[model samples]
Target: MTDSENIKEIKKLGEEIMIGGVRFKSNVLMAPLAGYTCFPFRLMAERLGAGSAYTEMVSADALKYNDKATTKLLYTDAREKLKCVQLLGAVPTVFERAVKSDLIQKFDVIDINMGCPVPNVIKSGEGCSLMDDIPRASKIIESCKRSGKVVSVKCRIGMNPQRIVIEEFARMCESSGADMITVHGRTRNMMYDGEPLYEYIALAKRSVSIPVFANGGIDSKEKAEEMMEKTGADGVMLARYGFENPLAFSLLTGREINDTKLSLILEQIDIAEELFDELYVLTYIKKLASYFMKKQPGTKRYKLDLYKCGKVSELRELCTAIFGSDDNAGLV
Candidate 1:
């Protein structure tokens, strides 16, 4: 099909996706990125047209133990009409306790993390490790589903050179009561360096009756449209691309990015101030700025300076220089 024909087809299937009983407004979802998809970031994506958004993976063990930091990650506001918290860890009892907690009960959906490829997550036997033992993973999903919230799982294609077990794994999750499944096309060993094996995602889509979302390396609107057409997934979840283009969801939906880059950054700073102390706000904003400016022209000369900024004001000044006025240049 031609590009317009492809987009026309996507528009029909990508409008919305239902998981369990929860209905999201759109099918362009923001994936649960480790450090990037916080409250402010979710709000930004939702405003930009993400049908749904997920929290960064919080540790189920941490929530079970009442860790203050983990509790804080559950923060939300009215703007995030459709949001889910992604929890990491392998303990069923711990996950059960977390699901039953009052804090977690606030979310309409609870997503379990079984796709992380980071060594630390693997060493803890929580992420891709779960794929090695489907029985144990099924138990965890059952435990989370007991809370009466819409439960979902995010997993990779396979652990390694093994057969890409996504079709079987997705079926296992559905049988275990997972309302939806997200399949990252890369194997655990590939990390983020390769093309997502869409064939595997397509297999999972065919195997499951529940909603399936395709994730991993969907970095542009064309890719989003193409994935939907190729895999017939219910949705497309964007990760690293979101860090560079917070408005990607809008673009996928054929909407323009409506805010200036400077405006977007300032708005995030405001939300950060409301949620954290000065130290945290500055550190987090700098981290976000690093990703936003990584590919911009003239950044190599001032990247270190931007990193060294200790306050939001200094960061704003640097961004003003790089992005110029809002009327002249936006995040595009």
Candidate 2:
């Protein structure tokens, strides 16, 4: 088949594997990144054309106990399409309760996070630590499935290099009734350091009948295509890379990156300002601006000025000086 035909086939395959009867537009999913995949960021990714987007890992213990601060992380706009909430915790009962809560059912899918390697998470037998105890993980999966929600699990290959057990664990997740799985091709010990292990992800895909998405090390469209070719995963998930490039989904799906993307970013910032308070919007735009300015010429000075700004007006002025002020003329 021609390259265009091949791309069409892959994109179609992604749309057919529904999590809970909601169709994804593409197989390229924006992976949830803590502190970055907040509502505003997810909205940006969705507008950029990602098939689906996940929330950062919300603690089951916090949700079940009604911890206000933690519960806030689960908040989302009512209009978001293909919204999925990812819960993290090793306690089966707490996780089950959290998933069954009326609050969580508002989403299209419920994802169990087993891939986080943060010290606090792993120390509690959650995240990557769950890989060490396959039985407990299986029980959690079973309990979650009993909630009648479409269940998905995101996990790494192993707790460490010496404990490679993804293939075994993936089978247990499927047998325990998980509808889908996302494999980040690295041991917990590797953190986000090395290139993702495509072979390990491929192994997980081979062992499971359910759709397996490959996550990690995908930062560009060429790399995304290479990952699909190598691992045969049903989808690709972007984490930090998406934060650094909000237009990544469109770029990978064959859309060229031009002034149009830059314009979209500006419009997204405007929406973010309207959706959230001015203070929150400024902070979000400041964070995104740093990423956008990374390689742009003559942005260093503007970035420095932006870092010192205390209000939204200051940010807007800085953006105007750097990217041009006319709303109709695309940012250069």
Candidate 3:
């Protein structure tokens, strides 16, 4: 098929995917972003069109210690059909304990985050540092697999542009018992910038028999199609842009989305309020609204006003102003 034809063919209603016998409604999915992908956010993405979404990366260390704050992050509702939690850790024994923790026991899939590029995560011998240490990464995956839950993994192609380990790492994850893998087609040093190396993701896809989801820089329906076409991944996971543009899922996947920004924002507020205290709700919503704020015009003043607003009532008003402003009605 021509490039144009290929793009049109993959429009949203892509194939159903079976990962570890847990079938997803469609191939398109939402990737977890730290401090984002809260239950409400994940819910909105699912409502908008994503087949399933993972929670923000949870620290295995926190789970091991039974940290209240970390447990709070694992909250899920029955509304979400497929619940997945991503764990960030390097130690094999810690993962072994974490998979059995009550905090994440309800989750259907446990995703090991081996691709985080944050400096502190790297310094601690976690995240992308594990890419260079395949033996430890493999052991961690093996430990998590013991949970008897469908275990998956997310990782980068290599440590730097100079080092490409897609083929080797992909094989390791499969042999270590990962049911699926999401390959962010970039090195650790590239962070979130630069075009994702589609060829590398393709290499991983070909190297592994398990399902591989292509991640990184897929911000639009067209990009999702292109990523799938280029990498031959079973599906594409929407990340940064997916957080800000939940509508991308509906647009790409043929999922019906009757809700508007104002309606969804209101729903998120109600849910957030129920799960968190007033101060936490205000701060969390304020941080989340910032992403939406970047999408609207005339947000300069509201962005400044956002930090100062601390009450639920005040946050609702600020969000309404920035997201549901008169001049930006249609944009929302």
Candidate 4:
């Protein structure tokens, strides 16, 4: 078959996926971005065509203790039907408490984050470090499974030394009760700096009994289709590139982004204001513009001007000037 024909086949296969009998509308998942994958971002991704979304990796210990701030990350709206919450912690006891806690009980699926490469997360013996100890990771899965909820795991292929244990690790997760596994195709040491090892992801897909999703370096529709064809993964998860272009999700699924980038920025501003205080909201709008304005000429100057604005009105005026004053451009 030709490349276009292969993409068509992949798109048809991507329509929906079932994991542990829990069905998601599509298989194009939004990988959990620590500070950015909040309710509003998830909502926007879903609106743009993400099949499923994971919460920013929350601390299981925080949830177990009923920490107010941590509880807020569990926030959801009516539109996010296939809600999945990813938890980070090294202890089975913490996970047990989290699964039984009210905050986590609301999610449709529970994901364990064994993929984070951040120093703090790894130093605590959580995140990608778990891949080094399959037994402990298994125990964590078992703990989450006790809730009778669909349990899943997200992990990197290996650690600094690059042992290539993804295939073995995935099988262990499946045997230990993981409904699905997401393999970020880089060793913890490589950390998003290079191309993803598609062969390792393919190994993971072949090794697991349950569903496996391939993540990393999937920045375009072509990359999505390529990963799907190369690894034969059940799904593909979008990360950094999705952060830069929210409409990339819709485009990946062969869907058009009918709205202008300016309108999306405006919508992001509204969502930010609703979810945070004025100062934070202003900062968020500017941060978002940093990505949204990348394709515009004199991008540095635009960002500098946006960063100088102290109030929402200044931000609005700058956006209007940059994107024009058409209010109807918001329609999608």
CA deviation > 4 Å runs, candidate 4: 1-13, 325-332
Model 4 whole-model lDDT (C-alpha atoms)? 0.81
Best by lDDT: 3
Model 4: pairs clashing at backbone N, Cα or C within 3 Å:
none
- Model 4, range 23-93, lDDT digits (tens) per residue? 87778889998877878778888888787888999989887567667866788867677888999999998
Error of 3 at 57 (Å): 1.5
Poorly placed runs, candidate 3 (over 4 Å): 1-14, 325-332
- Best of the two (1, 2) by lDDT: 1
lDDT (Cα, 0-100) at 239 in candidate 4? 89
- Each model's lDDT comes to 0.81, 0.78, 0.83, 0.81
Instruction: Give residue 264's error in model 2 in angstroms.
Output: 3.3
lDDT of 3 by residue, 204-319 (tens): 88787898898999766677878887777888888887877677777777876676566667788999898888877887787777776666776778777888986798888877
User: Model 1, 1-79: lDDT tens per residue?
Assistant: 4323333233343486667878887888889987678898889888887877899999887876676687668888676
Summing lDDT over every window of 10 consecutive residues in candidate 3, give the lowest-scoring window.
3-12
Residue pairs whose backbone atoms clash in candidate 3: 12-252, 12-253
**Each prediction's TM-score against the native?**
0.92, 0.88, 0.92, 0.90
- TM-score of model 4 vs. true structure: 0.90
Pairs in clash, predicted candidate 1: none
